[model samples]
Target: MSRSQRPIVAFLYDFDKTLCTTDMEDYAFIPSLGMTPAEFWPEANGFGRENRMDGILAYMYTMIRESEKRGLPFTRADLVEKGREIVLFPGVQDWFGRINAFGETQGVQVEHYVISSGLREIIEGSAISGAFKEIYASEFYYDAAGRPVWPKLTVNFTAKTQFVYRINKGVLDVSNDRDLNASMPDDSKRVPFTNMIYIGDGLSDVPCMKMMRAYGGQAIAVYQESNRSGVEDLLAKGRVDFIFPADYSEGTELDRTAKNILRRMAISDALAEENQEQLRAIGRDELPNQARLF
Candidate 1:
């Protein structure tokens, strides 16, 4: 089938902890400032609490303040360079190609997206950055000299859902709020919620995970040993449909489950297409018999 004729399945991901082993900053940014993860996070979080600032903004500010104090490079280029230090989880480097090939065999178009609270610049510089159609994340507004001046975008847990809608409507432009907020029929959407799969980590992912459950989409939480209990709590609370180890290797549980979801969504798309065709053939506005749809 042609690209437009094929059903589209979107795989949405959280960058930190989900794909990478830990927070992206922990890999290189924090250490470059002569601070450990232990020292930085508490300070950042504490700054937010004390100033009633948004946590993401607080961290961005802290990164700026600390780096400047240490006479370190705090330019956008500097941040992107830090991305090179990020260590991905098992098989993540090959996961996209494998999943995309499987989607082709099933006659569906697969797309990847990063909906993250991490720095967009950092994610853009990662090894697998090219795999995604779009990376929606917190970002810094840089000056003419390439120094970060202010927060251009800040994606907290709740803000992540906006990217989901953007993907659904094929409105990838971040500046186009008019089209994003405008009414459009569900049938006219580029990708339905049923064709989306969201992969995230723990509590910070709850809003997006719950959105998946409430809609027809699927929400999966991947955990490391350190965060297993947290993800388990999410599962128990019915916020996530599945919890797996953060392994994306071929034949791994995450890989198999992702392929299965793709297959199921593809079948559902085919059935929906057939139903529409039948309705058109019968000159009916809707199906004559609701039971005719399986």
Candidate 2:
């Protein structure tokens, strides 16, 4: 089938603690700064508090300041190197391809994306970076000397929904505000909200999750064994549609759930196509049910 004929299903994920065992910084960057996560977060948060800065910007600033203070390189390459240390949940490396193939069998095109508050450079270094069509996250501007000089983008919890809208509209370029903001009918969107699925961890994911739920997409929360209670609470609060263990291993609850969602979306897409075809057959394709009076 042609690309235009295929139904597109997008799966958006949060990086830290959602796909991996812990925060991305906990793996290497913090340690390289001579700080433990426990010691580093409070300092970062305190700096944000004292300076009245956005938490994402504050942390990026802290990274630069500390790295410069210690005479560390603190370049984009340094971040990519640090990303090498991130450990992923079971079967994460293979999960994308498996899901894509499953979507093909169900007659849908599955696309993956990362909408993370973590560092884009670091995630770019990850083994699974190839899985995503786009990875939106905080990043830095490097000087001619290749040292990180400034924060280029800071993706906080509330701002994540913007990327979701971008995905829905197929406006992946972060710089194209004109296209992103232009009004488009729901049916004209490249991927309607109902065809999207957002998978994330707890609290920080609530805004995007709630947006997905409100817009007819699926919002699923995945938790670690020790963190199941938090996700359960999210489910209980009706902020998310489903909850499961973070295990991405094939046939696991999370994996099974993902496949099921894809299957259901494919069915919905097929039924909608059939409805359109029938309408065309009956000369009702124009369906003169406009709210406006001619």
Give TM-scores for every candidate, taking all chains together and pairing residue i with residue i: 0.96, 0.95
Q: How many backbone clashes does candidate 2 have?
A: 0
Candidate 1 residue lDDT tens string, 242-268: 999999999999899999999998887
Each candidate structure's count of clashing pairs: 0, 0
The top-ranked prediction according to TM-score is 1
Model 1 per-residue lDDT at 38: 100
lDDT of each: 0.90, 0.88
lDDT tens string, model 2, 1-294? Answer: 133689899999999988888989889999998889998899889999999999999888888887778877577888898899999988899999999999999999899999999999999989999899999999998998778887888899999999999999999999999999999976678888888999999899999999998878899998887888989999999999999887888989888888998888888777666666667779875332231111
What is the Cα-based TM-score of model 1? 0.96
